[model samples]
Target chain A: MPEPVEIGRLTFTEAEIRRFAGAFDPQGFHVDPEAARQSPFGGLVASGWHVVCAWMGAFVRAHPSAADSPVDHPSVIAPVGVGFGLQGLEWKAPVRAGDTLVFFTQVLEARASGSRPGWSVFHRRNSARREDGVEVMAFELRHMAPDPAPGRG
Target chain B: MPDFFYEDFVVGEVKAFGSHTITEEEIVTFAREFDPQPMHTDAAAGAKSVLGGLSASGWHSCAIMMRLICDGFLLRTAGMGSPGVTENSWLAPVRPGDVLTLRRTVLEARTSKSRPEMGLVTFKFELVKADKTVAVSQTCLIMIGRRNPGARLA
Candidate 1:
């Protein structure tokens, strides 16, 4: 079993939550603090997508080799390639503004891709917990990465 | 207060929504903050990558799909929230300038055994391009409030 790697921590501010939600979600509970108080969530909450994106942001930034590489550099290899899909995504708890979340990813399986030459597939379990230790979100992500073996496709 | 309630969704019902156009600026901006791979952030690097040209990150496509869902009927529905997504697939790269639409189908609906006030609705959501190609698809269960929780079946 591969050990879990910490992605990094993130604090969800009201402004950032509102900004992201305004663009992609626009739900009252996410974008409007006052309106949210009148709803079931009881306060301004981050969109579920925002929380997922935060995990991605932290994961990309934490990659040792991919970090600090110029965006235009041709030789810059990303830590992971395009994702095939995700499964069993869960939002267990509400991520309200001012909450800080710690993220982690653990590799569940890895193998050569049968269909995509020169690429390998990785199945990983990604999760996040609030500062209070409540697990806020989790999902199984499948992505492809180029095989590192020399002379491989 | 909303037009749609748990009782409103009929299994196998299909609905279409959205006509949002993906833009290069939005794709780059979203990627710069989240995914940030070369193919998603830089046009030149994208041209050199396997994705062929500048493309929206898969997560961005999901976000866009969420927006379409909200605009479609979620906002006017008694949508409590989603427990999770059972599956999400990125079928094709979403390129800039591609107009996307959402095709939503209700797969199943059942009243919650634990919470009679709410019901669980399973849906298959597809984000389709103008050419009818599905770029992304997701299957998930959402909790919706029942319009009349105390009503009895005849």
Candidate 2:
């Protein structure tokens, strides 16, 4: 197992949250301030999907491995990899607008696929916490990473 | 139409949701901002990669699915909120010019043990192409308000 990666912090504004929700989520508690205040959450909260997107943005910024090259194509940036699936995703807390969160990801397991010789499967967990350190969301993500080393095939 | 309450969902019934046409420009734009992988952002680069051609980010597919769900049902339903996804899979590549539709199936429905005012419904969603290819599949749990909050328990 490799070291855990701390993807940097992110903050969502009311305008940004509203824009994303208006286009994607559109729940009253996510898009309308007055309606949100009357809703159960009592405030404009970011969509769980929006929180995941922000975490992806943070992941892209922190990982230098985007520049890593495969043995065959030393000049090409390694592919971003393909997702296999996600499991056990839990939204533990609501994220209101103006909340700043720090995100982190860790590779839990990795092994070359026995059926597909040139591909490696990675199981990873991603999570986010508020600036005060309360966990807001967590999920497991699985992806197929192309083998960088040669000779297995 | 009135909003749906706890008893509205029927298990074993299939509900069809949305229709959206995929576009190359939107795919690239979304990728540049969120995913940014060569396979998703650059057409030529993607053709050269194992994915074979430009493809929409799986997250983008999820976003589209959310829009469909809201427009199809959630907007008018007595929707409380959701905990999160139980699982999701990208079954096939989503390419430009593919007209996508979503279908939902009610797998389970039950009143919440503690929160009697709301009920939990588990749904299986499949985002399908015009040719009937399933591009994405997911299982999600949602909380819906009960029409009669205390009637069943009482």
Off by over 4 Å in 2: A1-3, A65-78, A115-118, A147-153
TM-score of chain A of each: 0.86, 0.83
On the 0 to 100 scale, the lDDT of residue B57 in model 1 is 92
**lDDT per model vs. reference:** 0.87, 0.83
DockQ per model, Cα: 0.67, 0.60
Per-residue error (Å), model 2, residue B93: 0.6
- Candidate 2 lDDT, tens digit per residue, B19-131? 99989998998878787766778788777666677888888999889989999999888887889899999889898998988899999998976888889999998999999
Query: Candidate 1: what lDDT?
Result: 0.87
| Candidate 1 deviant stretches above 4 angstroms | A66-77, A115-118, A147-153
**Tens digit of lDDT per residue, candidate 1, span A12-80?**
999999999998888788898888998778988898999999999888777656334443333254456
lDDT over C-alpha atoms for residue B98 of model 2:
89
Question: For model 2, what is the alpha-carbon lDDT of residue A30?
Answer: 91
